[model samples]
Target: MSQTLDMFATDDYPALTAGVDEVGRGPLCGDVVAAAVILDPNRPIMGLNDSKKLTEKRRERLFDEIQQNALAFCIARASVAEIDELNILHASMLAMSRAVDGLQRAGESVKPEFVLVDGNRLPKWHYPSEAVVKGDSKVPAIAAASILAKVCRDREMCELDKKYPGYGLAGHKGYPTKVHLEALKTLGVTDIHRRSYGPVKALL
Candidate 1:
């Protein structure tokens, strides 16, 4: 674990620092989900990596392990309406902030002193934070956050598929795929869709 971490560890984030990341940003439907995680150095989980790079089985296994082992974790989301109103970028930031703020309420710890977020932009908040380009692969906490958010969002997408049915939300995960585009034209757009998105907007 030490050997692998050496290749991807953050500069010098103190313990109890929260790592933040979001998922479902590129999906044409559903809320953008985010998660914040503060790992317990004493109870480390293995095989942490970018959620996109991990198999569903591994992510599912780690998902439970992280919740069981982390000092704190919180998952949050920005709704489709918020996406339409704020734009995806700001909405994603809002969700990320909500996640970190949630940790204060949800975690055993009072608060995280520092935050490391995946990607290049940090949410507008009071916390001391840095946005790492690929922090999901670089930081263990971020990787844990990545898994939580992805699994949570993907599960929601599956449930949403049941509700919305014909859009094939389960298979495409709400991405603007060829099948999704075809469904949009044939069956029409649902309220779950981000009306601000190009394909969705055209239909509206």
Candidate 2:
């Protein structure tokens, strides 16, 4: 119910289609995640906020609602290797681009006229894009996308936890938390970790 969120809800625009948001760019292990969401303006969800601001349970609930209600949606990722090769920023953009491409591939006839991305840096893509600072908190569509990306990346990290038992991936979700740093000190880097990252590279 913030003023910024309210503004996006009321903004008049043609073909206000999918919004884009990304996650995991800063993680030392795991892929860069992105999501594209197209909200139904007629049926806006209540209590929409940035994924980081919501509880896990709330985000899960919103994720389900978004998948069910949105006209089209897609989640995508750029692998840690890809992130290393392209650098995190470009890799994040590539992930977003892949999400947008997936939406098109799924037969969503209407292309987004404008893509509202959830950060100050805009991705280089064919479609027109606007980078909105704090967009996930301000725009419902971006919020939905953020939830999807976070959930998706969290799931991936959990899977990695099973593969690398001592890494605490599930607990930290591969971020550079104190616990994660401790784990890195003990276990060193895994194949899934971005060796190019400063903390991870310092281990080398």
Candidate 3:
């Protein structure tokens, strides 16, 4: 195991340290989703890595494993309206805060003493947290959070595909791909499209 992963497995960290991660920040449509996960030390999940590095099948499988094995987990999001109102960075922070807050509210497990968040920036919240540049890859808890957040958001995008159609949301998950851009140009923007985004703003 790598140094970081090894540290997590050892007793060097807090007993109740939650891992935080977010997804869909780059998507031009759909909400930015975030997840907070407190993994059980006794229930070690193998193959935990950055969600992007894993296949969809792997992520989906891990998503279930994390939810079933973790002491507590919560998924949260900032909607398109919130994203436009707060801007992506602040909106992403809001989503992350919500995820952590939701876990705290669940009251199913002991409160987290520390938080480990992916990315260099921490949300404007009261939680004692440190951001690791690639925490999702280095920390198993963060990796599990990444998987849950990604799977939840991807499923949402697939549902949006059924509702919106022609946008290829299921395929691209609202990223500004060639197909998405073409659909935007032809079909114009939907209510779900983030108007503050460059492509959507241009169309507007």
Clashes of each: 0, 0, 0
Clashing residue pairs in candidate 2 (N, C-alpha, C atoms within 3 angstroms): none
Q: Tens-digit lDDT track for model 1 on 12-65?
A: 777779999999889999999999999888898889988998999999999999
In terms of lDDT, the poorest run of 10 residues in model 3 is 1-10
**Model 1 C-alpha lDDT versus the unseen true structure:** 0.90
Candidate 1: residue 127 Cα off by (Å): 0.7
lDDT string, candidate 3, 65-183, tens digits: 98888988899999999999999999999999888888843456446778899999999888788898888888888988999999999999999999999999999999999999999
Name the lDDT of candidate 3: 0.89
Please write out the lDDT profile of model 2 over residues 1-204, one tens digit for every residue. Answer: 445577665266545567889999778898899999888877777777899998999888988988887877889999888998999999999999888777742465447777888888877778877888888988888888999999988988899899999988998898899999999999888899999999999999
With a 3 Å backbone cut-off (N, CA, C), the pairs that clash in candidate 1 are none
- The TM-scores of all predictions, comma-separated, are 0.95, 0.92, 0.94
